[model samples]
Target chain A: MTMPSVSDSGLATDAAEGSVVLERVTRAFQGRRVLNEISLHIAAGEFVALLGMSGSGKSTLLRALAGLDEEVEGEGLIRVPTARSVLFQDSRLLPWESVLDNITLGLDGPDPAQAGRQALASVGLAGRESAWPGQLSGGEQQRVALARSLVRRPQLLLADEPFGALDALTRLKMHALLRALVGRLRPTVILVTHDVDEALALASRVLVLGNGRIADDFRLDLDHPRHSDDPRLVGYRQRLLITLGVTESA
Target chain B: MSAEGSTLGGRITSSTPRTAQASSRPGGTRLVPRRLTPLGRLLGPLVLLALWELAAQTGLLSPKLLAAPSTALITGYDMLANGTLLPHWLASAWRAWWGLGIGVAAAVLLALASGLTRIGEASIDSLVQIKRAIPTLALIPLAILWLGIGETMKIALIAGSVFVPVYINTHAAIKGIDIRHVELARTLGLGKAVFIRRIVLPGALPGFFTGLRLSVTSCWASLVVLEQINTTQGIGYLMNRARDYGQTEIIVVGLVIYMVLGLASDAAVRAIERSTLRYRKVIGS
Candidate 1:
């Protein structure tokens, strides 16, 4: 089968070589350019992490990928236009909805309730179909978000540090959960994160961004659900540290 | 603070003993435990009553001139017994209910209309905010001139006064919906109705209920003012008539009844809101 192409909103796709090819995408807010000139290409089913310091254009890149913010002036080619979903860093659960309803916010299809339940089950929240997002812990809300994106089974997934705010242990577990989901679902995911280990743990391809450009694209050949400190990944982590220009912060 | 805490703890721990003692009394008590929050609310009222009764006993306040808690309670009961109080209270409640209901319904409809479209929102927001700022009490003169001194005019005035709150709250509620949620709905192809029903209304509900409670309070307050017109009944009419008869106790009694009604209506709406949005606390969303 040909490699899938993901949409701008992180839906799965069948676009072969350059599913997302940004030549020189730039975004400026009130004459201050947030993204100066970002050119990158994301392949199909690629778990690519955009890692950078705060305000280093990683989220700006992800936003451009998600099509959430089109305020930037740029040249970009994004395949698979629809069937996409974005998991915000905030979890953004509908306050009034049950976990299942939050996963499927509004179903515009044949049977949304059933689909929503299935989505809930996909993220290991099977028994919490009737549970409200408020009742759930912070971890559980993020899991609902994971389920939402999983439900779409899109060509791409845009996650802006989806587990950035989680506790150390929860974030570790969520990393595993996300890796498992991406492997099984195979949606081309673009995660904007600041954690180098997280990038190594969750993503197959880690793109370190700085000064509004892809500074380095590190490919980790390790399989899904890898440990945080895998031996082969250790060297890659060191390389990422160098790429991000962090002086012994690791 | 320590004493208060200890007293609270004592109440919690001695509940069984108290209930058992009550059961053994000459008139056996049917004891039902109440939650602390509600019990806590009653403490202030009870303290005020105790102070009033003490003042009356010391003759610092004349029971005839300024009825104490006990005297007022008796007077209130007397009015209740002679069938004068119930009708007046009930009539005021009825008019206030209609005014609040009609006002809130209109507000919700207008909010939905305005919130869904920029043109509707823009056209109304400027004028509505301006009109809202103009005290509804000031409009009583104009309302009377236009609608005449009748029950119709009273209800209309009350409704008009309350509408601004409900409208503003509803509109704000609609505005508070997360833009991401709206985008999610659009991506899913949910039409206007489904989007409004599932996302917009629920998102706006908390604010809407807050506005609604405020509106009901205003409506009831306005009902008192509105009924100052050619009405033979209602709490306002009761107070006005008492003033004419030089019955200071009855006038005080009527005003107290209005206050109680306002408190009760607000409490009821709060209870409704708690049940409706219980899931918010549940999911931590």
Candidate 2:
């Protein structure tokens, strides 16, 4: 693939545009193609949820969009905002550093401590500047991780099954926190998950990957504070579960 | 209300602030009182001393073989009053200080060299392994032949004793950091210098302290051996002199000093570990 636009610094040329465009992107490992000629465009401030089965290349596609995987042997033009951040399934916090330092790490600014404090406060972690990551609960650690990502004020946030490891209750709390933060920050977010209800509840647009390509794309016009039993979402959930090959009875 | 919506608001309002605030407020209250441990540590030594005094007074144990606690104490006090113990103690302390300092510096340098790069590991690791296989005491003959029974030989011996544990532990610590953190550093665009300073150095610290505790004990042991080599000063020299004069009381004093030094250094390292590793006080830890 010719990456004429992706610079050596990996900063997006059209960063202010805050868009992601992938054209005919394909990736293979040992002659087995994992991603096959996938093309998609995400506009600024759009919440996009990617859904697929375990090996359906959902994560591979998300990694590509995040500029973390670049060894694909296919013709494509992948463009993402230079100001971008990724939140993985694990909260990947530095165990030794305090929560505030972890958020402000490698930060370039006039007053990073102040910014870190503000970010922590936004995540409801105020007065936890001196607390270590290990001291916090799993949900709290993920909140600090969220604060770390949001401290950069990225235009694009790519989250890969961030709440997959969390318990059901913690996942609900995280979903609410994520929704509130995304509403406030309005970054173009692409969340990768297999949870059909999560995608239906959180995303404005949900894309389903099947056989290494985009098989279904749905636009949901549901209002904020969405309910799991909204009755309107049952069809989308059933269709997504069917797309994921999960039979209702089996 | 659905199960999800009912729990969502209740969970958010009830769980978020209470636990976060509760966990953050335990720093002062959680520290066990410092006064408790001194009494605990003293109990063993005090009971032993009492047993020794009773045995000496009752004549159950011969004083020739083992000096009484009172005799050892009087001899120690007389040596202190006559100004004999101070010079010997100073000389031994100076040698230990120089030897341990040099050894730690060299070990840290070697560890960084070997731990950071494949080339460094290839060059230094095999030679260090060979050195580690041989005991430091086995090198005493060669050490004397090379540098004679001088301060240089003694100091070098102590340095050699301290080198292995510090280097091995520090290197392992550097290599043992989780790769996920390295990815985090790269994703954050941390520069090479910053990565070494922030991640590599702090990550290696716990192991470094472990190695330091080991090396401190070994450093004292090496001194005990090296100071017996035609030494006119030091605690080892004092003990050697006392052995000839059949001054078992003085010999016991020397032994007590060594014990004190070892205990003190270990306690110092433990204090540092406690303060630095306070982050490890997670639930059930």
lDDT of 2 by residue, B77-108 (tens): 99999999999999999888888999999999
i-RMS for every candidate (Å) is 2.4, 1.5
What are the TM-scores, per candidate, against the unseen true structure?
0.82, 0.84
- Predicted complex 1: DockQ: 0.38
Q: In model 2, what lDDT does residue B48 have?
A: 91
Residue A78 of candidate 2: its Cα lDDT?
74
Model 2, chain B only, scores a TM-score of 0.82
Candidate 2 displacement at residue B107 in angstroms: 1.7
**Candidate 2 local lDDT, A1-250, one digit each (tens):** 3433223324244745688888777766555667788889888999999999889998888877766664544446678887888898999998889999999989999999999999999999899999999989999999999999999998899899999999999999899999999999999999999888889879999999998889899899999888778888888888888888888989
Query: What lDDT would each prediction earn against the true structure?
Result: 0.77, 0.86
Compose the digit string of candidate 1's lDDT tens values, residues B162-277. 88988998899897788888766755556888888899988889888989888867777876666677788888888777677767678778778878878888899988999998
For candidate 1, lDDT tens digit of each residue in A132-199? 77778899899988887778767777888889889999998888788777778777788888998888
Worst 10 residues of 1 chain A by lDDT: A1-10
What are the runs in model 1 whose C-alpha is more than 4 Å off?
A1-18, A73-77, A224-232, B1-44, B50-75, B179-192, B282-285
CAPRI verdict on model 1? Answer: acceptable
